[model samples]
Target: MGRRARARRQQQQQQQQRGEEDGGRAGGRRGAGWDGGYPEIVKENKLFEHYYQELGIVPDGEWDQFMGALREPLPATLRITGYKSHAKEILHCLKNKYFKELEDLEVDGQKVDVPQPLSWYPEELAWHTNLSRKILRKSPQLEKFHQFLVSETESGNISRQEAVSMIPPLLLNAHPHHKILDMCAAPGSKTTQLIEMLHADMTVPFPEGFVIANDVDNKRCYLLVHQAKRLGSPCIMVVNHDASCIPRLCIDVDGRKETLFYDRILCDVPCSGDGTMRKNIDVWKKWSTLNSLQLHGLQLRIATRGAEQLVPGGRMVYSTCSLNPIEDEAVIAALLEKSEGALELVDVSSELPGLRWMPGLSHWKVMTKDGQWFAEWGDVPHSRHTQIRPTMFPPSDPEKLRAMHLERCLRILPHHQNTGGFFVAVFVKKAAMPWNRRAPKPQGGTGEPRTCVQPSPAEPTAAPQEATGPSEPDPEPGMPDAGVSASPESAESDGARRDGVCGPPPSKKMKVFGFKEDPFVFIPEDDPLFPPIQKFYALDPSFPRMNLLTRTTEGKKRQLYMVSKELRNVLLNNSEKMKVINTGIKVWCRNNSGEEFDCAFRLAQEGIYTLYPFINSRIINVSIEDVKVLLTQENPFFRKLSSETHRQAKEMRGQTRYAAPSCCVAGGGRRPCGPSCPRTNDCTTCA
Candidate 1:
């Protein structure tokens, strides 16, 4: 390139960074260059510089390098979708076939490999390229690699977003049998990961525990379903609610209903998102001191609510796509201070084997265009317009403050990992947060602190009227104290069915799934449709909370879903409180064919994974070759199958990539590239 051309480009970028006109290079869209295509390197934002200097965290010597990294496009990184059947083979295929195109490349006299596996990720399923996707699009050496991504991403075998986005899911430590909640899930890559973790322990499709993925946006909740649907987790229940005021919920244990709580919560809140400058190029031009400052209050409330919803000793990971102090450490500090000893930060350096990260800074600053907002115009009414909160600023005594534990938080900067910048803080609820009681007022009158009233063994919230169910003594001695029922009647009573605690912000939108019907109702055991279907699949009658059916948002066929006992109780208890966008995986679809095994009720692909363990019959095992053929065909029916295999095959012939068992089940679900199904007895080995 000519020197003049480079100089002109640099000058244009500087003007854009200063919030000057971008002349038409960057357009008005956020991540303008990154919507399904390559993103341009970013420019320097001056206010961002002033804000970073105030924090005094970055070393002065490396400051320029840190600043420069944000402007550079992030390296392309992709992870094997963990639960997919062909995940391992796809990983091998990339290294052996596509990546082989760029072998032995030389850059500045140094030999460079194509893609290197991220050692931190399990089984080295993740990879990173030194070159950015934007450059790769134009590079001749990696043409096959780029084409591989294009093909696999469309096939749902790969996710092609920024790599730093993958960090939170890794740190979440989700697992089967653990009730998990993802507050603010959308454009849901992380939620998908959570679902994978929920199903990770399953040899069959069903998991004992399930994921309750909540997002405020109704539309985005559907998107989350689409992303989560790829892995075919039947255990996922997608709901929409404001994270700050999410309602307390209940679930049925054994045969009785009780209040619900989560074992794990992910509070990945929305922020200024300047850390995404590498991918969202518009951040370079739109960056301002007020971005994080304005969002501090909302972020704090979301984190606080997540803490409230967590079970005692449950871990909640708070994260953001922002590098700003207010959004990262300050929000966590404020939550810790408000918890008053109920929360403790977990040191997680040793968690992900080889993950490299920096500790969160104990010290940070609150800055605005006119210097510190709190120290300057904080008392002014106009400052409230910027949504600045008192908790956003540093504490008077840093050690006496919750900010002291900030050192345990993880900060991922662009330069440190060749990815986007991110901040993650894991907190364990040591005890129930003392809500409803006002602390001694602080120096200035700020907005009201967090308030929640829910009953638990440790902290009883508002005492709810006893639900009407079968009268039975508590099964275990301490079960009653923990709100576990001995056994509910056949179902909850009609009169007590609608009981709930009043909480949560008023729903902005009027539409909700299963709002008209009592959402808590389980599928009746006597339902003629379910018995035949259960018998066809050889299911143990009590397998999942199959009786608990909530109408999902995809109500086109009036799709009825089955949720975990805990999730059902939550939906029932929190009904009419927060908006319920969608929940549960559909187990029974609208069908009237009445063919016994395949008619009147079709097993949803989403439900099949969790259903695998409970099913005692009707699952026909196919060879690896058969699995591959089924996965590749849109409407595959095999004549080569045994009669038993043919019976199930015809039933699943027109369905999504479901029903067929690979060496293991995977959907974005696909067939295995290796050996035949490993499930014993349940699958006939295509004999």
Candidate 2:
């Protein structure tokens, strides 16, 4: 019998022996029968144990400890938003207020350990707590702390994420000037981290960088939108697309069209998620070797596409939550071989000082679900050839295997650090891919004279022509091409071609799926809506007027949003090529009562930080006590304020706006308001 079958038989024998011992000790009591009311123990999975045992992934004499750690529940972890100016204040509150109260508290006869900072995470912004979610909800001693977490999470001041999931973004090392992309970003916790890294300086209201977060599921794209909205960043754009075939977008640079390449890419592909078994109990029953086998192709495709779009010398991190070598080292080896020296694995052992991890495996065996093992591709039977591919095996040449440096990949295990298992491999692009190294023909009469036409907002732009370099070698029979076409030609083609230089022949474009969003309409520079607001606020001349846009085409615009100059270039050029789910930050909201104040648009809380620097006049500075009263009581009379503050408020004749420091209003759910006359019809409008 194979190893798996024998292991299962042995497990059954042990269970039977234990049952007999228990029955004899009970003296055949009626309540102790086999069918008695009792919950079944669910911690065992013979096949899971057997599969790992064969691989020998656990160190000598540590297998029992490894299995023990997987059976325990995962602890709760949270991260404070580091880019915000009030992040220090929130951390202070967590340490001094909440941690101090829980010092001597015990729940359900268990002592609760004080939460500690994740040493690897910078600035002590992240914490690890022994208390699980169930205890946090039911324990009266932690009630106030629980409320604090809920409030801060809702306000986007903090995030609760798995500790290991936060590693990829930090390893990405994003900067304010780099263009980043998050492939398969859904329920976006890591995407928010990328946003925080881009805004690390905090003083720059609008950064040059932007993040394009893409997910295959249409519904999950909204989750990304919700997360980005909480951070209130203008540089984030959520799009819906299959990461394996995400389109090549073009941008206008110096009046010339150029393909857009990212400086950093996060390819966190989907896997069997055996590492998450601690928190997601269902994985214990659902995991199988077949899952990694099926997902190998899709994962490689996504990583390859990300590499193709990365600029030379740029970095891309490929990560998964599975410990299976078939999904981790095997995939990285295949990608390295395909790159042909254009990509290399980066050694990041010293990046995270306190992180505990093992080097990636250089050797592993492949097994079928039926307990059939394959030492090499030649060992597979002809009937099973279709199920297994050569790329799934390690390189046969020992020297070539050593040269690839597969050991540079980091494998994080749960037993080492009370966290989920994760595999991360950072790659740096040395040159263009073999197939994409063709020299471009110069524009303007290099070939036949062709008219350059701009596509309308309603029409899709023509797809770019496939580049032709030296013929590439054929891949294995079942292996897919690394550079897959983003949009394929429709079957019913009319045989029309827009000049050969423009793109492919006329064909039906890929159909955009999901809810159709409102078109982004930029207001005219001379629009009638700008003069009054500009004069009232004394706006600076350097303010970008064309970047302000409304969602509606022709109506009383309810909300006006703003995007950075770099993002505006992308939106204007590639609106037809990409499926943008949401972008822009709300900067102005229409208030009907504001007509009496000579301006109909009022400041929005979501974007006050972005607009605060451009306003040259009509500013009010209030003290901390005044801010407390404004937050506690809605629309208090000016007479209640201190003398100096009352005089400043009375000097403003029309409707007034209030701006508070970030620390004072970080998690406070109150909205500040101006003093209003009792006889007025609107409470927000000043007399």
Candidate 3:
């Protein structure tokens, strides 16, 4: 056979061996790499297109291995605390829920395990059981995969290593009411996860609390905001800041060292990212023996900073996506050395099963004071001696003096479970931490940074002159200062009307919709909330017109008043009576007396998505029923006009002489099947 065929055969043979070994076992028995059940394009990058064409996957399964590799085990050490204390309650819940395997296990002590290897994370397993304390619930997904775990949980089968992702939320509950600091939180998966955990518990002991998620880059802060918003948690505060200065944020309250103390902190620092090679193929391309050692200094600084932020007895978790000893053990060693006996690596082996890895190193080497090399690889006497060899910390050094200053610590890695490579080291401040005893809170004397609230109704214009009538002369020719309102006479002439009928020239009013607080709709100083351009409108039917809002008088009030400018120059102008609203962050309008209406909103991009409510509108986060009612009511004549237009268009298109009326060509010709044309059967054609 050729090389490719031989490799394929070997892969198949290995998979077959693993399948036979784990065939009858429950809870997703692990044997080897991937079984043949997975797509073949996943194994080789160059063959992606071949497999995609044959098997039907886009990009030929580009991220196949990165995503698929999560199933593989990593040597990890998991430590679980809260679960052990709640083991009995968990067992009872599982038993009552009809989980026979859980009911059969021993639950007398801190933990209870089945003879079967746990398919779920020990923490998540505990949480699932805890949630079931009140009812018998079976997860259909988990139950379908691993029959041995909890014949019930098979239906809920998520990957086991994903449990590492759940730790923040679970711990957040166990330690609700405590301040949190997530150092190096970017692309904030863990930060948002923590917020979600806190949201899970409504009656947290402490009502006033927030988590500070910090990273070195401003761009990352924006990304963090996006993640936090999606999780919809109110407690997150994204900060673009450095981690090394965290200790300086510690403050003194009375003498107890209470200010700026976090109950839980996570230091998922940057590293060579070796452990994550499964998902991050770039790491494999970029990997080098020197990278981990290079990042060691930065890692140590961040870990030390986390230690400094911990409250007396508070806990911190330092983690990374790299598996190198320099990035993991060496950094922890440096932290302990700098701490001077204030931190301790706690024994976590008992807390989590399937995570029995090595402890922090001690007794490693450094350059001797006599300028002599300690390792056998050292020292060309005088010629090459000019170049300094890298120094090392003790392999078994516990930094006992440094550890004596704190309460606890633990570590986690991926090799222990078939998941992306990762590492974590947990530490706790002593009940009376020894670091600077007291420092100022990071917020400074200015008080905590408050969110920029949109101006309230009562706080209309900052200056009365800014909200005054537009009676002033034009100071700079055609310039109109921002806050002036439109003339009452002009408002009456416009066919577009809101609220009641037009009153006298001086008393005419413009009423805004969906306002809970303010009945009077008027602009003050140029409202930053309003978009620059307003939609056009016309009273006459079938006449096209466009309108632009421009300052009529110069001064502060010029920001408020605007006159609708007609656009007779442009053909088929959208003549809609547009009202821009502050809420909904969008502009709503309807053509002159026409039922068909359009709503527009600006996205992160400068471009806009103008939605036709009358069409099969694809709106989000709102009920379709409610949308239908709102659209129909706002555009009373929309249905009649839309149906007539649709029928006319169809009739025009069906006429062969017209060659299908082209919306783009206007005069009618065959529509070109350009880049967006439907080559395949699955295309959803749009005009």
**Best-fitting candidate, scored by TM-score:** 2
lDDT of 1 by residue, 335-416 (tens): 7877778789988888887767778877655566566444423454663644555676656674666445777888887776
Candidates sorted by lDDT, best first? 2, 1, 3
**Stretches of candidate 2 above 4 Å error?**
1-41, 138-140, 439-512, 634-637, 654-687
Error of 2 at 20 (Å): 29
Candidates in order have lDDT scores of 0.63, 0.75, 0.39
Global lDDT of model 3? 0.39
Candidate 2 local lDDT, residue 556:
88
Clashes of each: 17, 0, 75
lDDT tens readout by residue for model 2, 1-687: 999999999999999887677778864434354466654448777888888898877787988889999999887899999988778889999999999988998888988899999989998999989887777877776888998888788767889999999999999999999999999999899999999998898778789999999998889999989888878788988988778767666667778545678999999999999999888888888778888887877788788888888888899999999999889998899888888888999999999999988899888888887777897889988998657777778989898899899989998888998898899999999987776654343334253212112333243322222211112222221122233222323211212321111122222433334546667777777789888778766788988877788877657888889988888877765655567788878877787866655677776666756776677655555666755665556556656656766665556543454231101111112222211112122222111
Candidate 1 vs. true structure, TM-score: 0.72
Stretch of 10 with least lDDT, candidate 2: 660-669
Clashing pairs in 2: none
lDDT of 3 by residue, 1-687 (tens): 899999999999999887676765542343433454752222233222232233221123333543355334332222122212233444454445535544433333423222122344443343322212112224442242233233222111111224455444433332445567788887766775565345344332112445667776656666666655433233455554456543223222333222245678888888887666545555544555456545666676667667765665677777776655456666665565555556666544455545433444333332322333343224334553323223234323345534432222233334344455555666656533343433334333443322111111122111221121111111111112223333554344433533221111221222221211211123333544232212211112311112112222223222221111111111001111111111110122212222222212111100011112111211112233423433345322213334544455455455323333321111111221111111111111121
Measured by TM-score, how close is model 3 to the native structure?
0.41
User: At residue 640, what lDDT does model 2 achieve?
Assistant: 64
